[model samples]
Target: MAEKGDFKHEHMADEANDNDTVDFSNNISARIKNPLAGIRQDVLLRDVEEFAAMYDLSDITPLLKKGALVAQNPADFENVEGLDDTERDVLRDEVVHKWRQPRALYTTVILCSVGAAVQGWDQTGSNGANLSFPVAFGIGDTDPTSPNYTRDLWLVGLINAAPYIASAFIGCWLSDPLNNYFGRRGTIFFSAIFCLLSVIGSACTQNWWELFICRLLLGIGMGSKASTVPIYAAENVPALIRGGLVMSWQMWTAFGIFLGTCANLAVYNTGAISWRLQLGSAFIPAVPLVIGIYFCPESPRWLMKKGRYSQAYKSLLRLRNHPIQAARDLYYVHAQLLIEHKIIGQTNYAQRILELFTIPRVRRATLASFTVMIAQQMCGINIIAFYSSSVFQQAGATVLHSLLASFGFGLVNFVFAFPAVWTIDTFGRRALLLFTFPNMAWTLLAAGLCFLIPKDSSAHLACVALFIYMFAAFYSPGEGPVPFTYSAEVFPLSHREVGMAWAVATCLFWASVLSITWPRMVAAMTPTGAFGFYCALNLIAFTMIFFWVPETKQRTLEELDYVFAVPTGKHMKYHMTKSAPFFFKRYIAMNKNATLEPLYRFDNVQSDAVRSASVTAYNQEHRKSETTKKLNL
Candidate 1:
């Protein structure tokens, strides 16, 4: 019986092998006559070849046994360069044309924008609460005879900072792994529950400790919001416009800041109920995130990594408007993951945190993350957001005048963020950061100098307001957006969430330190000196971005991994040039010699540099022909 069973299995295997050979032969012959047919045919087969070549999978039996046809011996990885400029432009145009159909990309931008709106609400809730809490609680100088006025101030700062301390670090840590296990919707749903609880807890607190606990829990919700929402936004948008759309999230954040600041003034007019009302207003937007995230799609990239191919295909279709071949898009996402999994295996929390420094590209990325986060916090963005009114009053503006000016500051923040959002894709990440740093540094220096002017002088106060506007205008576009965008994009898929969590944690960590320190700094050194210190920090940030920051704009997440994952000099030489001169020079010469050589096509392995260049050029030539055909000129 055993012998007969073995004979039967062998016979079946032979039959299957025969069938596969016939099909593959038919596909090759069919594609030989049809270039467009070959364009889509055997894409996965190409990927397998590319993967085998790039990763040296000839020795790996399972990959071979799993139906991948072996090709030439794998090439040295260093020998692989990106597609030359001509090819890149062609492929880029092809991708753009594909992305322009029914506007699934636009829908993705909108859904992710909604999530950002929630983030705005979360950050701004405390902004208003910061101001009115003291007034509403009736903690005052009359009590200085009983308790030091300074102590009350310290307590206010503590209470104000408590949520960021409690929430920021922990939420960032949890966002990615949870998203992996539960999907984007599930993580967002859980986060919204935290938001709801915090909101209810905020409205019902009976004493300072109760309020503190409530704020602490609210911080947890806010932390979740801070970490997960931006990830969703980045993952949803197409890479071409990713910077612009993702930066829009920060724009909404600024809008929220502005709204919250304005709300403080509106609610302050409510007499005894001011702070309670201010704290509770956050619930309005918080309700929508809980309800809305349910309707949002899971990140298609995340779905592909888990081999949930059908779901990934559908999600990609939804995001790209069901382009000519939606499933074809997964090839790129999957190929990138295969390379990433080579380094990180899969998402393990402890392993990821460690790998952030261990992997060379990841280490550069982690540094980028840390620098951007540090720059943002040290730039005094929070001071503007949380305590602008206070700064204005200390600089000798009337309370009414200062609060009103803060409202205008919020408006300017939103207005200026539009240009940042618009230009992030066009100007690129490095350009925006490079351009904004000088303006921000100079503005801070000028604002600090405003403090040197006589307190009673109206002209000095006018200069102070100009400084405020300058600070918001410069910051809203660049420093504010770069940190969030860079942290989310730089890490590979396997470790992105964890990396982001740690990055956000760093920001929160420093933010807590700064938030706690700012009041004391102001108490000790006055507003001018404090602003001067921030000016100096901006100078440091300027140098960091100039020297170390790579432009992530217009690059796919996979391309980013390719760029920074290698040693610095090597990565830059290939990635920095828009048109890789080496590839173009090599290919121009190689094409003359190898015109008769079979063109290589592998799906899993990236196209060989020359062949990839040809494919890119082929697409571009086709586009030019198509455009000419369209115009009938």
Candidate 2:
């Protein structure tokens, strides 16, 4: 089994011509179009001996001459200097090409999405509950002029936020152990069962305390499912589809919220008991999740981690279209496992947590994930998701009108979710974050500004609602889904489940802090003030994304390990543009030995529409290649 870069038979004379490296610019798009798509591992790993001697110029020039590899970017050169350029290229490209998409892959992603939907539905129902349940329980008055007008700020805040303590902390903490023992599917299965009981209990609550207990239980399931599903989808799908599929978890969560909003609208005027039915409908989605999850294929990476090699192979075969493709994927899974096993050794939870911070690449990944999760919750979208009905009511809508507006919020969330899945792989995760966060900040500020206009004016309220809708439009593509998809690809299988739990726990922390204290935030500062705070948070998120996050659109999970591991330098960020002289000047300053050519594959022209348009070209090329080899020739 020679490494795939072995050009012993195919290109020896070409390799011997040191200056004959062909122009790769034309094919760079082909490579960029599917950086993480799989090619055969056997084709990638055939030149073991030559690649092993990569430090010797004699060993390196051959592969470079063969046009099978290129030099690392100026930033990456220091770290990867020992490896020949061609070996790295094949290593990345093959991993992408080796995977053949399978039908079961989609089935598994959809099943996991049920858990996401369950979480969304639960959140939206509670948002609606805040509309009518406060009055029903005799805790607060919707009308300030009523006889029973006291807000009961303590009880109201407790009722609203008690769920977070359970869901964010306890539920998220529980996910790591559950995911470790039962795997992602089993964990989501148990979460669905718990949610079934919790949803019923919530609807039947007689007091604020009873409702709080029920919601706390609901949080347990919501938190677990939220933490587990994205990574499960990431592991099962090929990279070409990974962003779209993993993002669908968020989309389905939006779907669940849509169902919840529609339920609320149905029951808004049906008397005191209508809230109960609104809450109870959440149980229905859980029923399918509990039953369907067990039938879907488990993550092959997880199977391999547990030493069930045969089962891992079977699972991969079901997920991939070709046998050799399945085997090749397993080889990388095994290779990464072996590499980590020897270096990482045996570790306890404490050690793993410590390593999560200490390991340079993994730590950067964790920080990036944790930062995005925190930013996402704090970006002010949740304010709308959890309380749009109230925001509408406060803005001048009647109770029914507010409920209808909330339904629109959910509808927008659900409708825009489709675009994220369609474009996430091409648009690139970092680009979306960079582009959308500023727009979200401005839209929220505009909505807040609209509040300062004269009271009882329908025009002012309409402006505020319009701003909220626009805010949601910006949020759906980037902040809504990219965080989960980005978090899923950063960790190796060894730490993936627990690593994801940690990222989700960051959500728990922010969601808890934000959800628990939202009322106080609005009361202490005016609503306008609160919105201003979130606007600042979005700007902070934009700053972090600009400097820290790398483009991870088309790269494989393993290939991303290399992307994040690139040497960190403060000066490296500004020169990332397309100017060749700027990059060459910087390259010379750092390393004179490496060649002076532009190192990165993508350019500024990679807009969402442009990136998405190229996928058809790749597919057409692939179809043409297959036809060329067939008897139709």
Mark the 10 consecutive residues where model 2 has the least summed lDDT. 69-78
Please identify model 2 stretches exceeding 4 Å from their true place: 1-100, 141-151, 567-633
Q: After superposition, how far is residue 163 of candidate 1 from its true place, in Å?
A: 2.5
Model 1 earns a TM-score of 0.76
lDDT of each: 0.63, 0.69
The lDDT of model 1 is 0.63
TM-score of 2: 0.77
- On residues 1-633, what C-alpha lDDT tens digit does candidate 1 reach at each position? 111011111222232233322122112211111011112224434544544343334343233322222111111122223324443343344444534533555654455455455445444555556555665565534243566667766776777677678767567667866777887678777877776777666766666667777777766766666676677778877666678777766876777777766776787677666667667666665566677666666887777656565566567667654332243345445544543454356546787788888877678788878888888887777887777777787778766677787787888888888887667877878778877888888898898888889977777878988998999899888888878887888887777777788788888778777767777688788788888888888888877765567667766676566446444553344333522343355576554433231211232232232344455557769999999999996
Best by lDDT: 2
| All models, RMSD in angstroms | 11.1, 10.4
